[model samples]
Target chain A: MSQKSEGGLQEQVAQLYGTYVDMVYRIAVLYLKEPAAAEDAVQEVFVKLMHWLARGRLQEKEHIKRWLIVTTKTTCMDELRRQKRQSTDPIEAGDFCSLPAVWQSGQGPDGERLREVHDALMRLSEDCRLVMYLFYFEGYSSAEIAGMLHMNHSTVRGKLRTGRRRMRILLEEDRE
Target chain B: MRQEDIREYFRSQGPSETQKDRILAGVLEQYEQETQGEFHMCTKTKRSVSKIVAIAAVMVLTTVSAFAAVPEFRDWIGGQFGLTAEQEADLAASGTLQNIQASASNGNLTMTVHQALVDEQGMYIIYDVDSDDGSAVDVSLDDLQFQASESAGVFLYSIEQKVLETREDGVTCMALLTGLEDLSGQEVSLSSCGLTCRWTVGETAEIQKIEADLTGKDLWTGRPYHVTGCGLSPICVKLDLDGAERLQDSGFPDQVAVEVANTDGSVKTIQSVGSCGKETEDYRYQMFLFDEIIDVDRVQAVYVDGVKLN
Candidate 1:
């Protein structure tokens, strides 16, 4: 490759990482729950982005973002499956300390509330957690989330409802 | 916790800048390593070609009025599809590259098939779509249709369309179509909108293609399946699975990783060209196209789901 093309590639990759790294990491966290594993998934997803951009298959920015989300989910699912095969025990949310240091230490103003919410989220199933994350945090409609996650629309809605009810119960138990 | 709190909590959990930077650096390093490996493979292929063919390749590159489109097509193949120099030379010397400046106009857009290179495995066509008023124009595989002569029994297994460039007046695109049968010497026709064009498939140079019987083969998904056969081509890998009755699009095992173990003791996982799958009757067929035309001779083995097929 020429210096010019290599420079172009660097620029393209940096642009992609800058634009979507956070989104990819967030989605991976919803699926993987472990920060280190999520970070690894981020690398895999971006490597895919580099290959796609090099091939000129990525059409527009929106499409690229869509592809990244789907790829991240798939990568995390693969990792989860590998984990399942290696060990009979499933990866529970509490198996690892997924709470951030700030939330765990309760240092910020609403740190305790944030930690409670995190615990409640960790209690939900991965799919339910992902649907809730996309709907509430990402501001995606149920239909759009369904399309991105490859789930039926009704399933997405049901997951959202189930997640909300379960989290409410967990949070209420904490108050009591 | 309230929904607002839940959203805010997860929002704050995004990775830190240090973590993002570390992941980005790792990805860039991986890309560079893969790119260097490909560079070495190309260099090795060039060195292995016969000197006579190399000389003839040079001659054709410099002075071939009959092959006016060879240089442009060669550069496009090299730049976009990353064909090795030896592969490009073989295509030219074997008379497989065809220069067809055939054009057809529909409404305000004129579509011209600039050049085409065909082999028994697949066909690569370079074309241009021009708008009458220098407006933006685009063309996709869905907008076009292909038909081969009935005697050839050539069915398109998969097709990919890529826009090479978007000039002010129009866009240049490349369409790669892999087939289930031999395409060489078969007259194939294409139609988009109301315009139609035809071209005879050219003779191809010797290329490595592995045909394997996939009876009772299991995919990485561990599903009991019966694939009719497998074709390992220079540009793509074609797979036909029988008894895929009532399988939805999502049910097709698209993520079965295709890896090429090259003769150089390096394994290259084919990525990014994306795959196309078609369901006909009780069959699910797929073609995994490479971003570049690979030198299949360099591939020592082709593996799907860790099972070595060739």
Candidate 2:
């Protein structure tokens, strides 16, 4: 490759890295629940991107972004799966019910609600949790979620519906 | 309880500035480290390729008996032409050949000749040949003329050998012709500014095999390649090996087809891969093609055909 072309590609990569680093890291943190793991996941995503660029594989910018998100999601999922496999016992029902200290320290109604929502989210199935994150946090539509997850739109919509219903029920029961 | 209420609550509880700054800083630092490692790896690959070329050149210069007498002369020739020893040996073996290799850099073409066969009478006759292994080949042609074909928008050549290399702007082609005893029965004709000639002899179906090692690269990500004149609308085809589907898009009017055929006879066809939008730098919409199916060990190969459109 010519020096000019190589330099331009490097610049584009650096710019893209700067643009999506936050999104990637947040996705990782949400999935992994550990800041250090999230940091590693973000690094892994960028490393993969750099490899793609060097190999002349990354053709377009939008495609590159989509790839990074999907990869980050998958990597996070795989880490979760591995953790699940390593543990002999499944997480009990009360695992997510236990509130963090901050929530119980005489916080406001919003803080209590946030804790409830967070607990309810943790009780959800992995797929439902991912759908909720993509929808609520990532601002992805059902169609975009389906594309990102490689699932049918109807399937994602169903997951979203079921997740919302479960969360609502959990919160209502807490109110009672 | 309402969806809007939930959204409003979450928005109101948005991450604090400190949290956002910490997350962003961590991410940036990680990305920088990763990018540095990748740059190091790429430099290593280039160095390895250069080393292989150097070793091959040394082996050829030391072992070849025919070119031993003219050591200084050979060195001079090698230095003047930037020919490695292996490249020189291949050229010595092939009497006449033509080849082209193209690569894309800033929307321009970088062409290099690996081999050529020069005609004794005119030195302009060229025959581009295909090698079993897709690497640079040696040619015997001395004088060559290169001109761009208006019809095909590809570079064409008139050499001593009766071969034509069809190359895109940024690709390189190499031809090697060995055991050139007689030049009879071989005919060279220039129909279009680009050689509209067909392969008269040898294999009728030249299956150009391309192997992409995407082991480390994330397969879920979409990658787009410009495939013109595929004759059919882009249809994603699944290969037999793994049921992974890949997106295929036909740029403009040309049909683009991505098919995966495995030895096991399993086949999967990917639907619409992704949407296409106008590129940031150009007016052309960048197409998004991705492998929809996942959890596979690996992908063997991907074939894109633009022959029908041509």
Q: How many residue pairs clash in each candidate?
A: 0, 40
* Per-residue alpha-carbon lDDT of candidate 1 for residues A62-110, written as tens digits (9 for 90 to 100): 7677667767765676577666646757667666465767778878788
Q: What would the per-residue lDDT of candidate 2 be over residues A1-176, giving only the tens digit for each residue?
A: 11113334345555675566666765665566555666667766665554445445455666666667766765665466455546735444444222345564528656677667766766777668778877886688998876555554677899999999999999888888
Provide interface RMSD per model, one decimal: 17.5, 19.6
State the TM-score of candidate 2 restricted to chain B: 0.18
lDDT of 2 by residue, B123-229 (tens): 12222333334444443335333332221433222222323434322222222221121222232222222222321111011111132332333322233433221
DockQ of each: 0.14, 0.05
Candidate 2 chain B, run of 10 with poorest lDDT: B200-209
Off by over 4 Å in 1: A1-4, A88-90, B37-310
TM-score of each: 0.45, 0.39
Question: What residue runs in model 2 are displaced by over 4 Å at the alpha carbon?
Answer: A1-14, A59-61, A85-106, B4-310
